[model samples]
Target: MSHISTINPATETTLETYTLMSMQAATDKVEACHDAFLKWRLKTHDERANYLKRIADGLRDRAEDIALLMTKETGKLLQDGKMEVELCAQILEYTAKNGPSILADEERAHSAGSKKGWVTYSPIGVIYSIQPWNFPLYQPIRVLASNLMAGNGVILKHASICTGSGLLLQEICNDAGLPENLFQVLVIDHDISDKIIEHERVRAVTMTGSDTAGRHIGHVAAKALKKTVLELGSNDAFLVLEDADIELAVKTCVEGRLFNNGETCVSAKRFVITDKVYDAFKEAFVKQMQAIKMGSPENEETQLGPLSSKDQFETVSEQVSKSVEAGAKLLCGGNPTDQTGYYYPATVLENCLPGTPAYDDEIFGPVASLIRAKDDEDAMRIANDSRYGLGGGIFSQDEDKAFRLARDHFDTGMVRINSFGAADPNMPFGGVKDSGYGREHGGFGMKEFVNAKAIYLP
Candidate 1:
């Protein structure tokens, strides 16, 4: 237990072993990051932005190798790995291009518009980032790019499964001429992680994971009087209205459900269809789900890959089994293949009632939950029934109506109309309720941990 072994989930082979660092060593790294921040904060916003662009270039230069390492460690499709790397670079470039204005000091009117004043965003100290393994590069880059632009040092404690990805990220940043110790990666367990939050130097924390874990981290950081941003996962619902384009609905649902091997946080997990089009949507969705070929991540033609780990595989399988025991009906897949890897087939479950895992929980796999609604109104109601509000989607031939519905009715943070997506560097990311609070991306993340000081002159 003292050493963490990285495994290739597809082949179930150990790729490398990393020893957990002592508490003293971990704290030293944190202290060093704080030292780096002192000098980093002295740099102008434009100076930090230049560093961000250089880091973006470094990511592209090594995209192939980083993507391959990601695929070997997490069972993500190689092509998807390449896309993730590109997405991360795009985020950095976007931040660099827009950061100067976003973080710029602005003149203001004060004393009832009779005097001059200004507002400035000054950097805090080290910010700790705890990210998941699903999108190893994208997750950390989103946090690192914005914070570094805001002149704050960052320390990432990546998911244990993607430790190598985290270390490689640090090297890339350094190679781009980032100031020494501006970014560091920690290879430690949860016990040491808690202590890191309690460290006197780490100014704020950001984590993306389950609500259960979010609560624990929130409580720990709160006791220390530190601000934290939590992006807990969601069981997003994609609704098919009565007038929805049946063809569009089917295609979008299939792609949304199976993307990232169906382990995405904002990916569609529940399908709520209006009774009028329920039959047609269900038939087409099931046929497409069954047609997907599950195979090795290295295969170019493979549509589905293994889950991230054996424990994740067992968790999804058990959720399906218990959902059936609690009255859910299975439509296509309910069992694992005889393959050597931890591969689960594209699964569908209907008759999903309340109090069952299929209806109430976020199943982090390629399983889709179907629920019937009386009409479009009922479908909207069903979509908002869960405690999560990360993101959702609506499929309809009436684009205007769909836009209005998404803008006015959907209870989630982000909504897709007649289509599907993962993340956008230009849009605000994060969610509400148990899906966690606060926002990232766009211009919001640049100010999340910054000290917004107000200055006045009379």
Candidate 2:
């Protein structure tokens, strides 16, 4: 059997290696997961909730070890790794607390006057999730927690870099009282993954990755007529309105751009500032970005860490160079540091044109793109001009106005007002346009892979 080596992105060293499951073995896993789903779906939501709560407890119990492992595997900051564990725990708890009602049958009105109608949510077979390396645990947990509560079995094909994290998570769930084979990790390559998607036992697919990956998965699943929920990449815009507070905007923007070493799908990437506050916001934002400390993710004092791998480092470096070549002004930090590891400094670029990567593409690293707008209306316009609409934010002193803009004008799946946050368990998260489709969390995910059967009684 072929083997896959796990590399520690921070140190560029091999951490562990696992033999890839053969295609036959992958098919066997699908059958096992489907069998588990048949039994698991018979359990009531409350019964399944117990397992979720225990899973949360298991996460907390192993939080330290899991966080450290993830930091070593993905190069996310140590603190961020811990927070990811907490977020995973919170997702489990949230689904446990709210899932019963979310999945409960709903009484419906019949088209004909005399009949009583109702709708029931029933679990399908296995759901295959393809997740990325960033936010390793939370990404899978976001899908698994809701599916488990909904009585569906889960299978994960995590990014190669985070295979260890995926295996460990499956182990934790099993140890926390999840039935064997209910959630399996497929340690296989893309070819085998594609075959698994076509397996009759695998009912649905969900993915959190780049736009290109999303397209490929969506196509493969579509060919099989399988349901897909993809949370793809985004160049989410953070609009600074004319009346925005410069200090608050600068601080929040800096935090948003550099969080997770600037490798988040929904983090604020494009800064569209109204001309009134453009110079002030840019000056302060660049200063804060420059002041960030870059070093090992293990260092608590380091605000920025290396990209997840050498490939990512090269991609970000190349994107910056191409953007600068395309006439974008490099305000600060356009170069990689001399330090070892896949390290890139906090970078700020201005005068980003429409065609360059800085303005149009998702720069998945510690680089900020600044765009000037004529006014508040123009800033809103600029924010909506992107092909991606995963999540965006508005920075203004007037909360009511910002809320209106987000609610009415922002064309994204999730919106933030004067703040920076990747996700919350209470909110529905996903994206629009090239960012892919379907929603997770806020009670929506529990129903995604379920069969919503409508019944009529006379």
Candidate 3:
């Protein structure tokens, strides 16, 4: 009978505790979800869509409570928590509205004659999702909403730190008329998680976490011959061309780096700027990063909150130190306060070298790395010089040129022009290389785990 403590990152206090589920219980729950999926899969697309709409409604109805719970569980701003709920609701509604068509059988013309062929998307059973703590609601909802709409049951093995948020979501879905066990939350350890992934009833697995974890899970699932969709680590490079608007680049880059307390996988971690505007952009960016207020997440005036956990704080702090030791100059905020909470000030690093963690690794905190590019060509080159490619952005006045660069040159899976955002329900998200594979959102998620059967008429 093991247990996990949910500690509030901002206060370093225990918020709640959850008992670990035994192996037998976990097995039973998987069986239950599989049973539910059999019934759920028999429902028509429109019938399933109704449940999704109600889930969206339920989220809106409990938005305030949900936001507060999320903020307490993960030290994100209250405003951001509320926004996460809204985003979850949007995902639900979007999936409900577009899922039917996206998963509908497509009619195709085959051969040289007028013979017709078709491809039908069929629902798979339970999809086991392993999500991280950042954006507790949005991360799980990103997968759950789309999968549910696709007529698959889901089992969530959320980050231990955000267990409460995970269970709350399950309660909301059930309250909204989701069939019992269609969405279940498993409070289990890594051992149980591995076992669950290998469970026969679990049709597919999806994960959002570090590259290391992604590799391990991908390997295990692969060994079991199970399909996986992994959205892993990233050191997203935001390029500022010489022709870029300094004001816009500075503002957007700061928001991109510090959003979600700088815990996002798609956050702008590296700033690759052309020499012509390097100094100007660096100065303005450092000023904004330095000015961020570090206080209670509940305070509207506070711009930066504590790291999600003490371990995260230590990781960011150590990375900054090693980078500085390896010749990276600390432009600002190298020291974290000896405070009660796991607070690390917004930091900016310059003279980032290739071998150092500051330049190579993803600094998952309020730290920004500035890289001076020889020119616009070099900026784009530097942006692609990484093993990871989750998301990146370009800041330039030339919208058409930026679009071409993003479409043709950016090596990442998702890109932004002149602005920054984690995700959009209407656009495909996920990445390549060490960032892992598969796409989510924009109706693409609806087809990830489903079978695309080819029906050919000769």
Candidate with maximal lDDT: 1
Error of 3 at 14 (Å): 0.4
Off by over 4 Å in 2: none
Per-residue lDDT of 265-346 in model 3, one digit per residue for the tens? 9999999999999999988999998889889998888888889998998899999999999999988997987889988899
Rank order (by lDDT, best first): 1, 2, 3
List model 1 lDDT by residue over 365-430, tens digit each: 999999999999999999999999999999988999999999999988899998999999999998
Which pairs of residues clash in candidate 2, taking residues 3 or more apart in a chain or in different chains?
A: none
What do the candidate models score in CA lDDT, each in turn?
0.94, 0.93, 0.92
The best candidate in terms of TM-score = 1
In order of appearance, the predictions have TM-scores of 0.99, 0.98, 0.98
Quality of model 3 by C-alpha lDDT: 0.92
